[model samples]
Target: MELFAVEIRTPQWQPMILWYTSALNMKAAVRSVEDGYALLAGRGWRLSLLELQEDEPRDRSAISLALEVENLSAVRERIESLLMEPSAPIETSDEGFLQWTTTDPDGNRIKLFQFVAVD
Candidate 1:
């Protein structure tokens, strides 16, 4: 089955929403402050953030959300504008992908990758 959306439960709901929208350039499609939820949509993916009462985060390291992007430079610029530093792009030519990674405000890993032809 095709994936519909990725959901993140976080205590830092508002900051997470802001970070995803501003840093990753995801569009805020639905926001319900009263309901403590937000939905962000990108090229062909949707990200949802739900408010949680827990102060400590779970082991989210087991899973990371990877995004396929067109312009790595433009995405990098947008990430930098949010004052959040992303890892340097690592080219895996053998694997036909160029990738970089960053974490959300709640420390969820976000990987951005672009396909590249092996020379």
Candidate 2:
């Protein structure tokens, strides 16, 4: 599985991003999240806010964009090799939720989600 280099950048004025994993319908994608969040919530998408505070962040924001990786293990290794400041424990999840973090640079919160092979 090749890692994707996709990155998202927010406008200069608007500085914040709220991410929620959408309940994907595709077959291959849902393999990890078996029986998808059934008991607690139905099959739409559950969203939880990250470290979002109103108390005047820096002149800049926390994160600029995210990086989707091939797997959790690889992503973890790649992040470590980069020698960047880790924000918090990579929100670990077995359902391929996401391994997220914020870098020291601009205190930008970046996310790397494990993705399945397509095609």
Q: Indicate the residue-level lDDT of 87 in model 1.
A: 60
Write down the lDDT of every candidate, Cα atoms only: 0.75, 0.41
Q: Quick one: best TM-score, which candidate?
A: 1
Could you tell me the lDDT of residue 50 within candidate 1? Answer: 78
**Candidate closest to the true structure, highest lDDT:** 1
What TM-score, over all chains together, does every model reach?
A: 0.46, 0.39
* Residue-level lDDT tens digits of model 2 in 40-97: 1124422212332345344354334445665767667766767655435657565545
**Model 2 lDDT at residue 22:** 36
Residue 117 error, candidate 2, Å:
14
Local distance difference test, candidate 1: 0.75
4-117 per-residue lDDT for model 1 (tens digits): 467687888988998998888999998889988887999989997878778665765434576778876678668866655546665565668777677777777666777788
Give the Cα-based TM-score of candidate 2 against the true structure. Answer: 0.39
lDDT, residue 65, candidate 1: 70
Runs with alpha carbons beyond 4 Å of true place in candidate 2:
1-53, 56-63, 84-87, 93-96, 104-106, 115-119
